[model samples]
Structure formats: C-alpha cells, structure tokens
Target: MTDHTTTPPFDAADHLPDELIERIRARAARHDAENTFPHDDLDDLRSAGYLGILVPQDRGGAGLGVAEAAILQQRLAGASPATALAVNMHLVWTGVAKVLRDRGIDDLAFVQEGAAAGEVFAFGISEAGNDLVLFGSDTDAAPLPDGGYAFTGTKIFTSLSPAWTHLGLHGLDTSSPDGPRLVYAFVPRSAESEGTIEVRDDWDTLGMRATQSRTTVLSGAVAPADRVVRFVPPGPNPDPLVFGIFSVFEVLLASVYTGIARRALDVAVATAGARTSKKTGKTYAQDPDIRWHIADMALAYDALPPQIASLAADVDALADHGARWFSLLAGLKHRATATAKRVVDDAMLVAGGSSYFTRSELSRLYRDVLAGAFHPSDPESAHATLASAWLGPIES
Candidate 1:
C-alpha cells in the first residue's frame, strides 16, 4: 500500500485521473481493515494537490470552485467513501476561505495560504448533544489579552485529527465584558505551546473506518490573535461563514454519497451481468426482476449529480437564494445520503452472498452511507428547515 516510487503530478482535472483514483482505491481497504487513517491516501492526494483545490491559482493552487470539487469528490467516493469523507473536512476550510475572499473578506486568507502551503485544516464544529448544529456551540472561547481566543471543549468527529495543522472551530465567549460572542477561529498545531488538542483513538465504528475521525479534546487550545477570524452574536444570524460552511460542506458531502450511489448502481449492473440464474440458465442481467431493480436504483440515483453540480455552481457564482439557500443546500445533502443508502441496499441484494461479506465494498458502503444520515442538517433538522422555508417559522 505504500508504493511511493513515482506517480502522477498534482494537475487534477474536473474529474481526477482514473489511475490515481485506483491507486488511492487500492489503499482504502487496507486502511479500513486496520481502522487506521489513510496516510498513504492522504499523501497521494497531497502530491496531486487535492488539498489545495480551493486555493486561488494566484496562490499556487488549483483555484477551483465547489462545483468542480463536487465532481472530483464523486469520482473519489466511487473508489473510497472514507477517503472522500476525510478529505471533505479539509475542503470545508479552503472552500470557506474561498467564499470569504470572493466576498472581499480576507480574514481567512491565512487558511487558503496554509492549504496551498500543504497544511491540512480540519472542521472542528461538532460537539456532543449540540444539536443546534452551527447555530450554537458548547465550546468556550475565552478572550485573551493579546486579542486571541482560547478554546476549551470536546469536539467530536474531528476528521483528519492526526494530520490536520489547523482546526476551524467556533466557540461561545460568554465571559466577555460586553456580551456573549461566538468566535470563529483557526487554531493551529503550534498552539501546543499554550495548550493541546488531544485526539482520542476512538473512531471504531460500523464503517468509513479509514477516515479515523476521532474525538478531540481541546485543553485550552489557543487560537492566536491573528488566527481569530469572526466575532459574532450567537444563534442563527446571517453570516457568510455560516453560508459558506453549510453550502460547501453539504454540497461536497452530497457529492460523496452520490458517488456512492453511482458505484453501487454500477456494481449492481456488473453483478447482474456476471451472475447466472440457477432457475432459467440465464444471467441475472437477463432477468426482468434484476433489470427492474437496477433500473430502480438508477432512477433514484440519477437526479442527485445534476442537483449537486448545479447548486455547487450556484454557490461558486454567489447566487442569492436568500433564506432559501439553507433549505436547498441541506436538502441536497439529505436526499443524496438517503438515496445512497437505498441504492446500496439494493445493490447488496443484487450481489447476494458476496456483498454480505463484511469485507465487500458494498457492505462497507452500506455502513458508511449510514453516517451521512448523522451529519449536520440531518433528516429532522432538514425537514424543519424546509418547512420553515415554505411555511414560515413555526407558530411561536
């Protein structure tokens, strides 16, 4: 899995090169088998400049938008969902930086520069029982005299924990002289001098094992004055950081699961073609039932890629959906993940006993796809968001 003699350079297209994807794909199962982070996968992607895909070309990076990133993610996820998911955490930061810079908010320029300079950034917003999602945080952001902030909270599901150089996080600073301020900041590993980020080796789960998105314990992890980016009132106000994170994260996440659906559909088709029916002496592909199941899978899977692509492009172009954007973006993530689960189930049935094996890719996908349902803007929250969009806020 560590074949690093030579490989492709970092000039990825709209879709990643198939050979490189296959190389990353080859390492996926081993990483998952060991419940380890895909270090080789990360190294290969880094060599291909994938981590800097959102950095501006002027900054010695790809300068691509979320739309292009979504396409590439779909391709990557077809091979490895865990890899895609881990990479998604990094992309969120660069994508946010791009959104900020595009709107003339240079506060996150350091994040972009860091990405281009080969620094891995992790999304550190998740907290236990914090269902308010991005609207609030349990993390404490204590303001420092030098203008920086110190974060003390347990952030769960910190993807790329072992490798990330910066963690983009938000915390509530209630002890401020004025009022509670939700500070959004990037805490670098250098903060080990002042504090430490303790990453627990506790990511054992049903699937996506290769992600190694372990729990993080921030013991006064400090975001220096220069790294402190946003200071805002908490609880669901209008902010570009909010929009950028939701838009980029949901869109890219949807792309990953959409690719899962695509791969499942393709695998089902392949299985149908190769497996012969014991009853009719014909291939499963010839059976009307199998064809219909495959068709149903395709039907469910078809609408997502176009939806992901269009909405991602809209985000890049800065299209104004106003209050509707959250619903639209979150809705895409909800639908894609849900659809991928259904498609994977169907494909597993199509593959029969082989797919039932725990090591089978479809089996892994079945478990990995379930995680999407657990991400932000989950089904219940997504429905609430949509209902609020269509019918106005709840009666209160």
Candidate 2:
C-alpha cells in the first residue's frame, strides 16, 4: 500500500487513467465468470481516492456531489459494469451518512476517517418479500432490556457484503406495535458475536455478476440503542427533499447503464469500419443498413447524457421545494432507466451476433444494461410514484 496522500491531484473528468482502465477491463471477464468481488480493481479506486469522491470535504473526503459521482460511475461502468456496481453500495451509504449528518447525527469524524481509509460499506434495505416497496425491508428491531433492540430478519441482495466494514441496516421497529416504524442503524460488519450472520452464495444472475449481491441471514443480532438512528414514522411525511436526494441514486445508476451502451456502440462502430462482408468484399461500415444502424446507435449515445445532466441540474436547483422536487426526481429516474434499457437493446442489435458471444465486451455491456432497469429505483416504481403524486392520497 503505497502512500496515496502525496500523489499529484488528478481531474475526475480525465476518464480514469489508462493503467486503471486496463486493470478493470482485464478483470471484467474473470470477476463475472467466477462471480467474485473485484478486490483488485477496488484497490485501484482506493489508491486514487475515487472511493471517497462523495465523502464531505470537512471529513477529509473529496466532497463531490451527485453530479461528479455520476460522471465517475459512468466512466468506470463504460469499461466494467460489475466493478462499478460492486462499489456503488459504498457511495450510496456514504450519501445516507451525509443525510443523517444534516439531521444532526454528529458523527462526521468517524465517517471521514472511514472514507479516507477506503473502508467498504453496504446498504441493507431490500428484502425478499418487500421488494416492491423499494425502500421497505423485512428486518425489524425492538427495544431490549438495556434499551437497544435486537435486529432480526434476512436481507436479500446485500451487495458488497464480502468486503464491507460498515453495514447500513434498514428495518422496522417492532417496539412500535401499533404501526411499523422505519429505522436505519449503522452497525459494524464484524459485530455478529453469536455468528448468526450467514451469506448465501446464490446470486447467479445474467449481469453485474461481480456485484456479489447474495443473501444474508441474521438471527437476533443485538444492536445498541445509539447505533440506531431515529425512527421514521409511517406516512407521507418528512422533508420532501429527502426523497429527492434518493432520486440521485437512480441518476447514478442510469449513468452507468448509459455508459455501458456507449461502450457497446464504440465497439460496434470500430468493428464495422474494419470487417468486410463476404459477398461484396466491402467493409460493413459501407453497407447501407449497417450504416443506418450505426447512426441510430450514435444518436442514442449522444442524447441520453444531456437528459441526465438536465435532470440532475433541476434537482440541485430545487433544493427548497420538497414535494415538487421529489416528484421531478422520481420522474427523471423513470425516464433515464427506461431510456438506458432501450439504448442498450439498440446497441446489441447494431453489434449483431458477435455481441452475443461470451468473450465479447458488448455482450457484457448488454447484460449489465438490462440489469439496470431492475434495480431498486426502477422505471416502473418511479412511474408509479409519479402517478401517486399526481393522483394525491386517493391513488394509494
């Protein structure tokens, strides 16, 4: 571990160094094939301080916002979606910590230390049964004899569990028996004294295989009262900006999907220019149909980023209006995710059968892009949220 403290500062927009890009590109296949975490590539991110991009500056982090983080994720995913997906959990949880700080959590020092040290973190929100609710989880916490309640339940798709140092556990508080109370606890990943935590190696998926999004079971996991953040009451309440900030996660996800599509288009265009067809002895690029397909790919690739950028700018500007801002945020996510899926599908068609080959980079991009639409802030859920907002309380 060489000292990265004194390294010359680099711009995030330089599109990641060639060495790092080569490293991620080289391991993309192995990580996907073995369904293993991309530790080596993440090491590269740690060394470059890319992992701390979203950490606050006061906490020794780069203090970049969603915009810069989105750019970084897109560039990384352009080369390796699995590696990008694996690291995204940390960024999201760090954002949550920031939000907590705004609510007076006062634990900025610890967060900064962890970010500076490149500590890994995971968001444990999704559950097997409550997947439709997006933010809902099956785990619950209750008041214990000493005040802190025991957290119990299983969480599905706990990404980056293998390398995480902090677990952002989301669960309902059973102590409030009248209604479910949402609570988020920042627990040490190593705190399972009884060894009740179990990670299932059952995440066999079509894309982003290196994410290591397996299941984790926790039985009577004791959590301290202080470790648990304040409970969120059930209802359409809170500062609307809270939900708006969450929508930024979807934008980051969409950026990655768009980057994958861009990469696929790049490969298709370059290949089409050189490879000659058998019948005409002419390059595929000269064929009228192939050229038209290439044009369509180029058009799509050029169009999506501006839309994402505009949406992000809108969210940033609406920092005051809570409900309206949240609605726009959800709408942006709905559009971006849907468009990303369409763009990648077009990329695959342009690349032809070669894109389907196991070794083809385009094949991996296609798979990962498709996987993007199924993430938590998915297009369908975003649309439903938007519709609910439009219809008022009656729709729910």
Candidate 3:
C-alpha cells in the first residue's frame, strides 16, 4: 500500500487515494484465482472518479492529461496488473476522446460526457491476423438508410466485456460512396443492447486472468447514425482517430508493463535483502553479483517512467512530432515491454527457486509481462517503424 497518498510517483493529490489502491490489490489475487473480473475494483474506481480521469473537467472529471494518467496507471499496475490492464481499455477510449476534443474536434464529446456520467468504454480494435492494426479492419460496417451502420465481425481480446457500457470500434466500409472507407463508431452494450455486443465466456489464460478480456462476437451490432464518428479512406489516413487511439493505447499499455517492472524490481530487492547466503554467512544483498543484478534492474526500470512522462506530456501539449510521434510512441511501448520482460527475468533469477513456483507473485508477474509484447505496435512493427524513422520508409 506504500501510502500512495503521500508518496505518489506524481502529485496526484487526493485523486488516487491510498486506501482505494490497497483494496484493489487485496482483491487482485482472489479475482485471479476465481478467473473473474474485478467488478469491485471497477466499482471503487468508478466511484472515486477514476474511470473519468481523462474525461473533460468541464464534464465533471479530473481532466488530467496522458502524463498524469500514465503515473496513475503505473502506480495501479504495481499493485494489480490485471486490474490496471483491464481498466487500460477504458482509459484508452476516454484518452482518445480527450485527445480529439483538445484538437477542436467535438465528435467524441459523447465519449467524454458518457465517461463522466459513468459509462464504461472498451476498446474493440484488435482482430485476428490483422497486423495492419489501425490501418485496416476485418469488421464490416454496412451502411444504413438512416446513416447508421451495422457492424458484423468478431472483436478479440475485448477487455471489460462483462461491464462496458460502450464499445469503441472501427470497420471497413467497402461499398461507401467514397469507396473503401474505414468507419469508426461506438456500440452500446446494455441489457436491451445484448445482441449488438455479445460477450463470449472464453477468457481463460496464463497471466492477467482477472482482466477477463473475452472474445466479443458482434453479430450485426449497430452504431447509430449519431454514434458514427469517422469515415476516412483506408490505409494509413493520418486521421485523429488513428493518432489518438495509437498514442493513448501504446503509451498507457507501456505504462502498465513498466509498473510491472517496478514491482518486480522491488520484490527482487526485498528478497535479496532478506535471503541470507549459506555460502558466505551473509545476506544475498551483500553479494556483489546480487547487488549488480539489482542495480541492473534499477537501471533498466528507471529509464521508462521519464520516457512515458515526457512523451505523454508531448501528447498533452499536442506537440507536432510529425511522422516521428508514431515511431517514438511505438518505440516507447516496445522498450517498456522489453524492459519489463528483462527486469522480471532478472528478478526471477535473483529470487532463485522460490519464484519458479506457480503461486509466487514473481511467477504471476512473469506471465503478465509476457502479454506486453503481444499488444499493438508489436516488436516487429516497432522495429520497422523505428527503421523507417532512422533511415526511410522501405523504398516506396
């Protein structure tokens, strides 16, 4: 519980109270054990106005930017990665809305207002074999007479499936007047809106089990005419939707994994200090090699928070990084995930056989960190992006 109110990574004030985080941490293992969503955590967060951290202050939220949100998420993830990961989807959408609104685009105003009013949003962008990421989609957005759309496709790894009030998604509209438009919109998931957003019970996995990010099947889900937000031509149309989602998603995602690294390092340090070596009749912490490992873990973990904060602040300032923002953000994500994996591995080794057990916290962290590599802007994509930035886009 670290008295987060006083010792927060950022001066979060009274927003991220210490008690709320402790309660969230207490339930994480149980939720992981039961293979269930941390509804109570969500409830506490919702009540504490966490779900609306990115919603506009004018709209009854804290009205913070991505930098502060990154700090909050890192703190939360250090306590409970699954809860932080599950909530990341919601923050991504709200952050997207904030990014758009800051750019003088009022289209996603509904998202901000909805979030402030307690509407939960889940990101529904990832599709199987769709490495094109935001640049493409397998979902079909069939146009309607009333200007709405009927989206028919499966959205995988949709976190907060069991409780999301709105699902933000995009689909390819090939038959549009503009021809091959990538339509983006939000689909509701009320009881009356069941068929529109079906939550499939198929989220059994290794780490981050409590996220319950089930496979969502959209059997002709409808996003009303008003809900229809963008209709840009496909294949990297540099739209706000693209930039907003990409920046927020990758940044927040990176923040979560970085926090995992922080926790892992802390655990390793504690274990090292406590475990006395039988060989030298001294503590492992006193061993030069062990101290070196801890030093390496700190060295690796320290670089990420500043990077996240700096880039996130750039996002808040709406800094024009031109084509560089993509590579920078993607690189930050890639680095964070990679660093997290490396730190966790070092920590596991430093902890010795105790960490090998399935029930160990380090073991849980090992599995959770594995997922960081699988998120958007993956390793290969990030390298390609970075290469293009350093050299040039692959010869047309």
Candidate 4:
C-alpha cells in the first residue's frame, strides 16, 4: 500500500500515523461487538484533519487528490475497515468538490469550504430499489418559491448517520418546465430539519458494524438555492458531478477492499509460519501447497494498488476516457472486491478452524469482505458495463 509510483508526491504516514492507525484498530473489535458507531475514531480523524484531506491547502486542508486519498484509505482500512468505509462518505463530497474545482466548475466550492471548516458531510444518494444509480432518483424535489427545493425520500445506507452536519443528496424534479431533472443538493441536519430528516437506528449487521450506516428518512428536507449544485437530465450524461462521484467512489471503495486483502495476506503469512503441521512436524509455511496459496493471494493483491493508483491519477489529471471510464472503473471495483474476498477465504483456510470463531480477526474480515460485492457497480451492473463496452450496446 505504501508504494505510490502512480500517485501524488504525498506520504500516507504523515496524515495517518502508525500510532493513530493502531489506536483505531484497537477500538474496531469493541465497536463491532457493540454494533455502535466509531465515534472516538471519527473524533480522532477529525482532529487530525483527515475529514478535509481533499480540500485545498489554502482552505485549511491537506489538499490531496484522489490518488493520495486512495493510499490513505488503504492504510486506514488495514486498521479498521468500518471506520474507513464510514469516513469514505464524508470524503466523497470533498473529493467531488475537488474534482469539480479541478475542472473550473466552482459550484461545489461550498462543499470544500464546509469540509475545511469541520463540517461532516454524509452521502444520501442510495435508495431502496432505484437501481438506475446516478442516472435516476426516486426522491422528489419540490421547487420552492425562494429558488430552493424540498427533498422527500428514504436514502438507504446513509453512512455517518449520527454525526453528519450536511446531507448531500439528489432528487427528481418532475415539476420543472423542461421535464424531469435530477437535482443534486445539500441539506443541513439541525434543529430546523428535526421533522424532515429522521435517522433510523437500525444499522445492526453481520459485519462492519462500526459504520452505523443507517436508513435516512428525508421528509421534505429543504436545500437552499445556494446549496443546490446540479440540475442534470434524468439519465446518463458527461456531467462533471456524475463523473466525479463515480470515479471517486469506485477508487476509494477499491482501496478499502485492497487493504483488506493485504491484511488477510499478512495474517495468512504469519499463521503459516507460526503453526506447525502435526504430520510433518514442520511449519505450514514449509508446505508447498500453503506456499502456493499464499503466492496466489499475493499475486491477486499486487495488481490492485497500481490499478487504483493509475485510475485515480488519471482522474486528478482529468484524462478523458469517454464512455470507457465507466467500464474501467466498474472493472476495477469488481476485481478489487472479488480478489479481496478470495484472499480472505484463503487466509481463513490457512488460519484453520480457529478463524471460524467470532473472536478471530479473519472471521470479521470474512464478513466485511462480503459487503464489497453489494456496493454500487455491483457484479451484475459491472458485467453489463464491460459487455457493453467491449461488444457494443445490445440492439433494440
């Protein structure tokens, strides 16, 4: 993860020190066991200015790009996947703002300023069954007299639910004179929005429990005119907002899962060296089959960081890939998640039956890795994108 040949000239250790990583790692199991959000971890990250890493340095942030952020996320995930995943939601907004600003689109400058000012932003894009993803929304965006819009819809998997100050969301504005438009906006989570935003405390899950990415009920939550960012058509387009979100989300998600694979490999290596075979009276590391398995894990893992770094660097450099961007990003996400799952499974086998226990770290990783498959650009959608890219769109 430390190798950053294709990334920016930044060091992950400076922002996420070894001590801080270990501290977060120590708290992960407890938070997981209790099914509680990692409040302390968030506090520590905020104090370290990790929340504003993507904001411009002049604006009081680390001023890093997606490449650097990807490296930092990998390090963080190596310690605590849930914390890294939850924090990804906040980073997504700042990353999007950065993406927009890099291309001279300053509409989201407020997002950068907000992040630099210690305001936590939560991603409120996910819905229960609106599979169109960035292309469509089930949420209703009612136009207001003062040039604002009121959003009413339930956003599922709203990460950082309890601590977010701003909720970045999108809704469909069918009332517009020019047909349905997807309105991307930000709403505050304060006393004024008491009845509008309801966060259901039902995030208890099989793993990654520290995230607490609960369901959010947006009952006419208002986004002031100044905060409303985009008004794109209700379908696929080359809008910077959509590209920024998809690119950043896919890269960061890949980084987290890659980190999980790295951790699993390390654990497997250690287990192989320490555990002795009852039949041969030798360490498992000496067995040819175990060596091959570890090697396979290493091979699968070694390819991820470079891909993540290259794509992220391309994004920061604003390289145009046309329609190919979706296919490339979708493939990266699919490979990262699938490879991480395989590595974790192999690691569990190497660690033997002891890893099956709930107390084992590999067991936790086993469950956490399963969640990677369920994220956006899921296996089905990813395959579709790739097929369309290589074989051309299916004939009507």
**Which candidate leads the pack in lDDT?**
4
TM-score between model 4 and native: 0.98
RMSD of 1: 4.2
**lDDT of candidates 1 onward, in order:** 0.86, 0.69, 0.89, 0.92
lDDT of 3: 0.89
Worst 10 residues of 3 by lDDT: 1-10
**Structural similarity to truth (TM-score) of each candidate:** 0.95, 0.87, 0.96, 0.98
Q: List CA RMSD, all candidates.
A: 4.2, 4.7, 2.0, 1.4
Model 4, stretches more than 4 Å misplaced?
Answer: 1-8
Could you tell me the lDDT of residue 89 within candidate 2? 75
Clashing pairs in 1: none
Clash statistics: count for each candidate? 0, 0, 0, 0
Local error of candidate 3 at 318, Å? 1.2
lDDT of 2 by residue, 26-96 (tens): 89998887878888888888888876776778777787666666667777887798888778777776655
Q: Model 2's lDDT to the true fold? A: 0.69
How do these models rank on TM-score, best leading? 4, 3, 1, 2
Better of 2 and 3 by lDDT: 3
- lDDT (C-alpha) at residue 369 in model 3: 94
For model 1, how does the per-residue alpha-carbon lDDT over 195-219 read when each residue is reduced to its tens digit? 8888898999888888888899888
